[model samples]
Target: MRTRGTGDACATYNQFSLGADYAVSKRTDFYLVAAYQHASGDQRDTNADGTNGGLGEATASIGSYGNQSNTNSQVIVALGIRHRF
Candidate 1:
């Protein structure tokens, strides 16, 4: 599971995972998996040369759509192996 942004960075919504599979005979098998995730936030930018431009230019002079920030993070990894008859 993973999530981000929502009241004080939503506690960073971190995550981790792991898996494994093994078989040496009758066909052959060896599998492994792993996963990780991270999140962070606190850089809301209304766009003013601060980057993270999702909606900028002074809210388009009035339309209002200038506010985009990003600093969240994420990571994941996995290994695999299979054999079938």
Candidate 2:
């Protein structure tokens, strides 16, 4: 969880994540991962001088994907397999 901005123009984010892995053999494995994030409140824009400028809505980005959703919530899921030679 994290927070940014100040007063009524503050943005708060809550995030949760889960992961699991299973070994199928000595050199093979399967894995699954999921993440979710939710944002609340407002986020104000900052001027070059670091002063509050305009008002903006909060958004959610799952983990470090760098893809912020248009809304206030986001979810991501991934499944994969690994093999060794």
Candidate 3:
């Protein structure tokens, strides 16, 4: 199957995130977060020829990500620290 653009693809994705922060001495805070994403249906990914088509087409992902995921699922884990004066 082929699609003219992402609008034609029935691709779908879902994301889940959980995060929390702890204050340390009132000067800074430490944070940790975990996120996961999954894609389903016909994803219109960038094609080799650089066309807006299905798996072998399109130039961008159906979501905010840069490129369409080659796999149906994705996961991300992050940690950070912040301080304000």
Please report the candidate that would top lDDT against the real structure: 2
Better of 1 and 2 by TM-score: 2
1 versus 3: better TM-score goes to: 3
Model 2 off-target regions past 4 Å? Answer: 1-9, 45-53
lDDT of 1 by residue, 1-85 (tens): 6544554323334556677888877787888765554544342344567555442111101012232213344344456667787
lDDT per residue (tens digit) for residues 1-85 in model 3: 1223255566555667788999996889999987666656665555679976545321223335455445666666668989988
Residue 35 CA error for candidate 1 (Å)?
1.3
| Every candidate's CA RMSD | 12.4, 3.5, 6.0
Give the alpha-carbon lDDT of every model. 0.46, 0.85, 0.60
- In angstroms, give how far residue 22 of model 1 lies from its true place: 2.3
Better of 2 and 3 by lDDT: 2
For each candidate, what TM-score against the reference? 0.32, 0.76, 0.64
* Candidate 2: C-alpha RMSD after superposition: 3.5
Residue range 1-85, candidate 2, lDDT tens digits: 5655578778888888899999999999999999888898888766999888888888886777888799999999999999999
- Candidate 2 residue 47 Cα shift, in angstroms, is 10
Model 3: lDDT to the true structure:
0.60
What's the lDDT for candidate 2? 0.85
**What are the runs in model 3 whose C-alpha is more than 4 Å off?**
1-7, 48-50, 55-69
